[model samples]
Target: MTATVVVGAGISGLSAAHQLATETSDTIIVCDAAPRLGGKLHRLALDDPADLDQGPDLVDGRCGDPALPFTVDVGAESMLARRPEGLELITALGLDDHRVHPTTARAQAFLDGRITPLPPSNMGVPTDLEALGGFLSDAGLRRARAEVDHEAPALAGDVSIGSYVADRFGDEVTDRLLEPMLGGVYAGQSRRLSFEAVHPGLFAAARQGGSLLAAAQQVAAAAKRSNDQSVGSAPPVFAGLIGGVSGVITALEDDLRSRGVAIRSSTTVREIRREPGVDHGGRFTLVTGPVPAPELITADRVVLATPAAPTARLLRALAPEAATALAEIPYASMAVITFVLADAELSGSGLLVPPGELPTIKAFTYSSNKWDWIADRAAAGFGAGTAVVRASVGRFGEEQLLQVDDHELARRTLAEARAVPGWQSARPLRTRVQRWGGGLPQYLVGHRDRIQTIRSAVAAVGGIAVAGAYLDGVGLPSCIAAARRAVADL
Candidate 1:
């Protein structure tokens, strides 16, 4: 029987394969270059066995009790509790009861050498100038206030989020306020990321408005109203699994195996060969395996769930135009430094570092303080006074920072952590660095148009599907949604 081949073992790939397995009787084969699954979502074992996450991590935050067990979610730690897809999948995998939420969702920002509560914002763009003045300079505040009286510049097709916000609030606000939050999500330079692609709601509001600040307020209010009207009296903002986010992947793998899908780790696809006139009876041949011992597998349909770079490489010969567009999509590398500190007393989720404030690191999270499960684990095994803090370094266009040795990088991060409040007296018991090369995709200006073009090109080729963090969003929900959509298309 002709099989369906899925390239990459990331959530996107696994989700697509799972969907196919559920919907059809076709045999599904999943391949990945890495010896292990879960891609960037991996967990590092801690001295306290209870703290180990099974896979790699995505985003970050911090906070916890001193007497708690210190565990770290080295990859993505939480999902939007409101997004039903991730929860639905987790429940379907018999992990429904594992759902957990952060003890505290409040966060702060490190600005100009001081810690300040992040201003009320609509994805980094502040809605209230008075509240944000503590972080902004007099000039920055003036520029922000001026946005209300002034009309936003006419943006034609597509514009960078930074350019659009800067035109309204000047560079200082964009650099200090908007950049940190947006940078945290995309690891992209605001000047390059598309406004429409990154903040569609705000973009739509801006298009309808006389001023950006007013538009942002409207958007925030609408979101609040929508959230208030959501099914429950109150829905959680984010959710995590009891064991860890990696548990989700583990559960998924178990479920897929039970469904008769073949998951091959350490298998990389070198190229995809599209058969001519196969739109009627089309098939794809995948050249995979390492080096000289390459193996070929033919598939009735192919779903490329890998990141843009490798996907582009594989499709270079088969779908040149789509490959070109995929190749043009830029990526950013980042490193997460998880530090175990004894007798730590930090509170709140974490601190976001604005551009130029801390060139070496982007953000930091107090793990023990943020998640109760981590706190309980630490409390149970390690007794009290143990803390786990995670900090991330590197950004788009900042490859030099990521080139340093892990030891050196950890030293630099620890040194910087000392500067932040509550971390002054704490000493690290252990430190680990996880480097994610080409981890984040930048949604640059004209990104939507480029995606449409890519979609059209791929459709013309037929029997192929693409899904990943590069398309809809960089979060788990977005990847899962995109994966399901891709499978439906096939």
Candidate 2:
């Protein structure tokens, strides 16, 4: 007779619901504001030619550029082959072939800005030592290099990512490394992000290295080890489905439904009221939004896995203090414009701008060169023998860009990409713009503290739990982790 209700059909929600749904003795009901699941992780067709899976890049571009002529994955291009969860999910679904490797680069973060090259290790990180070497005078380079103390600093005490980076490297390095990395990954700002939260491994490595540089390198080396394992011989990179990440969602949803899970899409949850006086258990009073209003439905437990804003709103109705902290957690807006190209000449993975080059785009996946399938499908959707390329643009909070009409946005993104080193002479066949106004959650400095406070209040208030990219971390893997643990607690 015990039932659990999960709010939001996002990856986080879906992952948590999947566990609870299949668990013995507990029936589950999942609610989402949209008419479908997948949340921000979705893909669409390119002018009806083929579906374009979009979101942050997942699959690696190692197989070949997407513009070549073959199939490419849409979801994660190349997952950490080291991690079992993603692999397990793929295997259980009979998608073992979907799993591929990647081809990494020697000179990463190669941009036209004043960024110090991300130090060796993390994909998105640039280093002050490298930057100093790249831009400073001989004396400056020598001074900075000489300061390389083999001692690693303890990253235990709390600090903001920005403060930590600036203190360890320099303001310039932090701006380039901490800023763009966070922007590219979470659309967050280091100035407001918690050091421990943003770079847990970095902090942990520092604690272990006994010196900041050594710790940074240690973290980098561990990641490097993982990456090496992912691609034993081939170049280390990845790419995914030709249509889009939506393919993955489509497959998963179909599988879940076949298993008899009730998928009530567009069923907005207006509130999640916990039963009074229940410590570990409670009844959830669910109210679908104003439209398609369903009579109140009750449940023994509730799971919240939506974005911070909406989740915060609902939680506020039940717990005020928890709501405040959740509300305070900021989000970054974004937009994606996939451009179909006229030929394979302009095909290849795109470039990542340093913090200041354009301040808008963190980077673009050269879909053509990133995947063979995408590349081989040249111009199928466009003119015969043509090509397809996607231009993803905008920083998280560029309000003006956020408000841009699709046409203008498309034009701007194409123009921006063309301005890159080699694309100066190319022309775009067509453009498709997808807007995500409040999509990315910014993990500002002290975010961990804020989340801690929110969780404490939720526990004190009644039977409730918070789960999503915001609570634990962003990205597909992280979302899955957060959801599984929350629902298991039910």
Q: Which predicted model would earn the best lDDT?
A: 1
Instruction: Residues 227-338, candidate 1: write the lDDT tens digits.
Output: 8888646667888887678788888899999999999998878888866666544888888876688788989998899999898888787678989999999999998988
Local accuracy of candidate 2 as per-residue lDDT tens digits, 1-490: 7777778887777777667656755666778889767887766544432222232221111122335333332223344445455555666556656544422322235354332334543533433365555543465445446445534445557677776656655565566555666666776666667777777777666544344655566677666677677776434333343444345566667766776667789787887665567554556677775745556878877888888888788888777888999888877777766655553354235444566676356566566555555555644434454445554455655666556656556556666665565555554544456667777777776777888888787776555677888876776667777777776544
> Candidate 2: TM-score?
0.83
Worst 10 residues of 1 by lDDT: 52-61
My TM-score estimates for the predictions, one after another, are: 0.93, 0.83
Candidate 1: which stretches are off by over 4 Å? 48-71, 275-281
> Model 2's lDDT to the true fold?
0.61
Q: What's the residue-level lDDT of 202 in candidate 1?
A: 86
